[model samples]
Target: MLFAFSIAPAGTPGDSVSAAVADAVRVVRESGLPNETTSMFTTIEAETWDEGMDVIKRAVEAVQAHAPRVSLVLKADIRPGHTGQLRSKVERVEAALDEG
Candidate 1:
């Protein structure tokens, strides 16, 4: 499964939320799962639903330490019996573009 999520502290004083976001990303990185952090979201490849949700839950908690409330946006591509779709899926698209 590929789980992409964004977690941020809301109603904070500053215009920037990079610090809090970094905390969330740190959690993802520490998980040692196949993952990528982009400007909008962090995407992780997990073998099971529990694994992915556990990461997301911890990420939210990391951001929560920064503010009273947090905003989370989550999207998932749940394809069982598949692994490494994190890179393979993008590689397929890039290959298609090359073919075109």
Candidate 2:
């Protein structure tokens, strides 16, 4: 299986969330999954939200390695009032790849 995730800066740059995300990706890769793809997204630091799902969609296609299946992940925080649309896109891609 392939594991993927996207991350937003939880707080200040010194918060260490970015480091954790990187470490998580490394651990997932070390586990010996068939394929792995990671998309790191950063929104406008001033704007709370922006429509960047298109980037995620394209990144998945671009990063897919030579493997039977592609596993997509978004490491963004989905909290109250968050739409979590990227998560849906990731799942859809995973489903489409599996159907092939």
Candidate 3:
């Protein structure tokens, strides 16, 4: 399964959210899962549903320590027997664009 998520803290003083976003990304990176962090979301691949949710849980907790309100957006692709789709998905799109 592949999970893409974006987490942020609400009602922060500053206009920039890089700090809170950094907190969330740090946790996701520390999980050691096959993951990618883009401008909008972080995509991670996990063999099991529990593994993916556990990573999200830890990430949310890390962000919550600073801000009182936290927001999370998660999208999951539950394709059994699939792996490496994280990178392959983008590569496929790029390949088609190149051909066109």
Local accuracy by lDDT, each model: 0.95, 0.40, 0.91
Predicted candidate 3 versus true structure: per-residue lDDT over 1-100, tens digit per residue: 9999998888778778888789888888889999999999999999999999999999999889878999999999999998999889889999999999
Taking the tens digit of each residue's C-alpha lDDT, what string does model 2 give over 1-100? Answer: 1123453333243534444445444434443332244356322111122323434444344333222334454544433353444355569899999999
Clashes of each: 0, 4, 0
Question: Best candidate per lDDT, number?
Answer: 1
- Whose lDDT is higher: candidate 1's or candidate 3's? 1
Q: Where does model 3 exceed 4 Å of error?
A: none
Order by lDDT, highest first: 1, 3, 2
* lDDT (10s digit) by residue, model 1, range 3-58: 99989899899799999999999999999999999999999999999999999999
Question: Which predicted model would earn the best TM-score?
Answer: 1
Which parts of model 1 have CA positions greater than 4 angstroms off?
none
Whole-model alpha-carbon lDDT for candidate 1: 0.95
RMSD of every candidate to native, in Å, equals 0.5, 15.5, 1.1
